[model samples]
Target chain A: MTESQFPQCRVVPLRMLKPETSERYLNEVVKVEGIRRMMVNGPSIPAVVPYGPARGSPNPNSNRRTIKVGDATMELRVQVGSITFEVEDAGVIEEIRKVTNAFFTQFPAQVLEGKFMKTEASLVDYCRYGPNADPSVIGLVDPRRKEAPVIIQGRK
Target chain B: MAYTPQYGPGTSIVAENRRKQMNPNYKLEKVRDVTDEDVVLILGHRAPGSAYPTAHPPLAEQQEPDCPIRKIVKPTEGAKAGDRVRYIQFADSMFNAPSQPYQRTYMEMYRFRGIDPGTLSGRQIVECRERDLEQYAKMLIETEVFDPALVSCRGATVHGHSLRLAEDGMMFDMLQRCVLKDGVVKYVKDQIGEPLDREVSVGKPMDDAWVKAHSTIFHSLAGVAFRDDKEYVEYIQRIHALRTKYGFMPKEE
Candidate 1:
């Protein structure tokens, strides 16, 4: 496997964001063109009480609700701590930085440029997708998850 | 000469706060007023007004054991009433939370009686007779030790202690047990992730300045840095050295 050709940048706010805030931020970022793929990461909020005495009980978290980003609607599994994006080039990263700077007026957020995504597919990814796996999709989402990544359509 | 016990060693404000918490003689400042019923509700051990269930018969009715220890030591109210063992656990955020797991254990041990405190990296659990536990829980919540946003009562699934705070300055709870509404933090669910009948408001979260001033945890980014306290570092190094040398029976030169 070769290194990813696209440049990656991550938006790290001082605090984890609520669903509404994350949705607003995602909508703002998605407006910036040249972004190829994006990933939201944070502590997992399961559908059920995953463990303890209340295991299997319904976990009704306000933060885990479905959010509409651009034209795509997707359920948030985690309290979004940070967002990483693979962009077309450095120009796109600068555009993202501007969006982040303008958007996070209430709280400070940093747009860091570096290798934030898995460049090569891991052993688990190889086993899950087999030999002819899409490089863009690999390591994008959890291999165990049955659902595919949601693609936010461009501005109409 | 009389020997005075020092709860901990340090010069930093965080250390002073820690010592203040551990010193039983020092009265903990009442920061907020969380009612007993609210505490009982948050504990989720029993209903707010229900009677405390017992694990054994009342001590007064039971046959007395002919032991000297029993003769001298009086049973606590809960023990005498034969109440069942119950627990209250707390997860404190790393970002200038007033209290942390080990600090909680130390404070509880120094101040409370008949408690079995289990301390972990992120959370602290204290088990005691149900009646006694309610009282302890009340103190733990109402005192300066707890912050509405930075500290949370989480019986299980306590995973947010070390994570970053939410944009609203609240810790991340997977169960979403509590919510910040109208600037007040309210518990919609009990400690163990069970939904409550009604929202129990703790209070508005303390501002950053107040939280930092009262925080017992040493956080480099938010509050006092641990390395800044030279005496604490030296004490820790000495203890570490002693423990390492114990196998070889090392003596001080």
Candidate 2:
């Protein structure tokens, strides 16, 4: 099936100063009606201490961790710099704005309507995974991951 | 021609600050009081009262090579003592932080001696002999160059320079090395976020007014735009023109 204007996305540029606020905002936004999918963009947090005396040591950074969003839980790889929301219709935009305003107490979101999320997987998806790749994984996967641009399929 | 020294150019307060910090003769106003021991503890190199660890034999003990340049150039205290080279790094917030990476390097080049400073996007690291670095770190901490909220002494994981500040105006430290509690900022850990035996107070962060008045970076969002300063723009253009002209062909004209 091809992508359509009916399933549009509006990227809400959230300037959440902390991970706690991002978690709260995400949890609230997921509860809003007409929401289809979500993805966050920001600087990637390294799994271990990348440099200095504690090289290779487990990072004790409290800000970088897993967060709960409604029923689903996900590990926050990046500091939730901005949240892009895929919605069913333009009507859901107002609900997103309301929820963003309520949860983002410190730094609010500046909602911008655009095609921020990828609708389909690229040529790498066909060559690497041999054309049986899942189309749903196109926008769901983290863009910053090492194997991100390589694969489109959720399964081997 | 008579000798004259010039700092940076600009009519803005940020440029003025850059000039002030770079001018060796101009006295840096001490904003806070940090003891020598506190500096040592924060550096995490050697114990407060420990003997200076040397990389080589002291200059006096070692036979001096009678080179003309060596005779003319005087060795610093640390160099004479043959202390190992150590470093102190700082990350300045983009939100009107008083001292930026390049600004800090320019200031250090003008003021300090026997040093190697590496300037990056957000952080600046100055390497020097252990004793010299300790002394320099103390001055940097005590002066207006440092603001606990807008600046961080991070050896690693220095990511908060470009990030939005915390609610209380403190720069985000993933390690949580420093905490603002009871209206004062205290370091509970070393520069690399290793737990310290006792808390070291870095004092209160400067207010918005102070930071705005002293910021070296011309952040358009923060009200001071690089385009606003005509003289600064012209200076940059002139420098670029001259560099290109000289690079393509070398002549007096």
Best by DockQ: 1
lDDT of 2 by residue, B141-171 (tens): 9999999888889988888888866656777
Question: Tens digits of per-residue lDDT for model 2 on A39-147?
Answer: 6776666777677786776655556777666655577767556777778888898888777667656555677777786677767755665565656556557343444
lDDT of each: 0.92, 0.79
Cα lDDT for residue B3, model 1? 82
Model 2, position A139: C-alpha lDDT score: 52
Q: What is the TM-score of each candidate against the true structure?
A: 0.95, 0.87
lDDT value for candidate 2?
A: 0.79
A-chain TM-score per prediction? 0.91, 0.75
lDDT of 2 at A122: 68
